[model samples]
Target: MGVKITGIGSYIPSEIAKNEHFGKHHFYNEDGTRFGHENDVIIEKFKAITGISERRYLPKTLVTSDIASFAAENALKNASLNKEELDYIIVAHNYGDVNYDSVQSDTVPSIATRVKHNLKIEKPTCVAYDVLFGCPGWIEGMIQANAFIKSGIAKKCLVIGAESLSRVVDPHDRDSMIYSDGAGAAIVEKSSEEGGILSHYSATFAFEEAHFIYFGESNNLELKDTRRYIKMYGRKIYEFALSNVPDAMKTCLDQSGISVDEVKMIFIHQANEKMDEAIVNRFYKLYDRTPPKDSMPMSIDKLGNSSVATIPTLYDLVLNNELKGYSVKENDVVIFASVGAGMNINAIVYRI
Candidate 1:
């Protein structure tokens, strides 16, 4: 009784937004004060900190569910599984389908339902729903699929993490440069193979950190509109992750009975380069060693942070040999971890 990802796929947006794209834009502090430094200085500092040179943006004609379906279709094809055989379709996203013309997010029928409809999966028994646990949504979906398979309630499930962060970001906010648009999905099913998902851990720290990331008015006070966009206290979130994420990953790995040395890779959320590096370093420190070189494969340099989509997308690229200089072999152990809004943190110890 093992739950394993049989196939994986991702849809990286075709629209490339280089850092220079934001050079002409005005950036203001959270209190509406103008920056003393020029845009070039700000951009360089942002790149140095986030390791993001460029990011992808969804085109005007597409929405969140649209890219989700594309990734779902690719996963189904990669798995060679029939649509009708799927027992579940779970979509992990923060903002739903957002049109370029509207400031509102539409999730009337649920993104999973829309994805199923787009895929033409007519199986009424194929339960479809959405999860909004911040950036950890994708890994959480995978954990749910594992439970379903282990409980004998499902044989095959499609777990997708997709986001159009570009659609929800405030252009006036410098943090907007940390977001991108993309989709990634995996086909999880019961397998006779040896190793699969071994252990997982999740926690929410909402007591004092509930609003660490939220929807808020633009940093530019000149815009007198009542609209809100994705916003966060970058410093607070960074500190929160540094203090908690590493411990969560260690707990998950300890439960999996896999020693630190056995971990071949760690697919952490692409929130920030420095934050992720610190988290991983701390996780390795728990075992009294440093992270092995190439132990973490990152796509944030080009993709930015797609929230829930980051880990699955990075894993899909590596598994397909599409990510340069990174590859995974059979029997290799890996860890998937994430921290995001909801002040949530989660990790999954997996074996390939």
Candidate 2:
């Protein structure tokens, strides 16, 4: 038995924030000190490095669960499955809802619970929960669903990645610009077919790099704020991705009993265009072959990095043929690779 993705869904906020908007604001260092560089130069370098032109963010009134339920409803609809039919609803999120005036936030009822409430799911047997595996949370939720199905526990599961990064981002911090808000979800079901979720591999490097993406202190302590926003060590993460991520992808592909040439497409986390491209190139080099052009499609140019939502949202785009020249057909091998906070790195191989 295997588990396979049956449907995909996504929700992007209507608000479009361009690089210029961010340029208008002054960013500060982690210590709250002001940056000396001009905003234009900084944005140009950011675009050159990350390839992000614009991104979406939900209205401040909205919360992470609201974003998730939108995607979940669409996913269940796409699968022609009702919410009551779901055996599990797993939500992956970093911060719950920080819509309050204070920096303090809570996930007490769980994001999954809030989504279930949003969907009005009446099935008592349906389990609703949340996962906190950094940006890989959604993928980890999928992995867990695979285990549940393979072990004869669950038949269908909904895995969602919803983030309100704008709430957690330090607007004055340039690195905070790397994030946006969005939600993506997939419906997975047990299948007797030979191909579905083939294999998965992941690792947590929590030593020196653990603090690479952290929430130590607030850059802005004004406005009665006390929330810890996301802070990333860009160079350190870039170097880490280049060094370790490719090997993790290779390990997943190797364990799947397939080679680099067999994969029809690769869905990599939209962390950074350059870093993702380099990692894929290195993966192909392991087989002594050049990486195929456009095999790895990217959405960071417009969507920015939506954290855990990136892969699934991109997956939805490809499935609907919304992406140019990137589509998933039957019996095609696909590889997914991601590296994010928690210092988490993981890869998943699937056949459709």
TM-score of every candidate:
0.99, 0.96
Instruction: Compose the digit string of candidate 1's lDDT tens values, residues 1-352.
Output: 6789998999999999999999999998889998789999999999999999999998999999999999999999999999999999999999999999688999999999999999998889999999999999999999999999999999999999999998888888999999999999999999998799999999999999999999999989999988789999999999999999999999999999998999999999999999999999999998999999899999999999999999989999999888888899989999999999999999999998
Tens digits of per-residue lDDT, candidate 2, 79-129, equal 999778899999998888678354766798998999999999999989999
Clash pairs, model 1 backbone: none
In Å, residue 77's CA in model 2 sits off its true spot by: 0.7
Model 2 bad stretches (over 4 Å): 100-102, 220-224
Collision count of model 2: 2
Q: Ten consecutive residues with minimal summed lDDT in candidate 1?
A: 1-10
Worst 10 residues of 2 by lDDT: 218-227
Q: Highest TM-score: give the candidate number.
A: 1
Clashes of 1: 0
Candidate with the greatest lDDT versus the true structure: 1
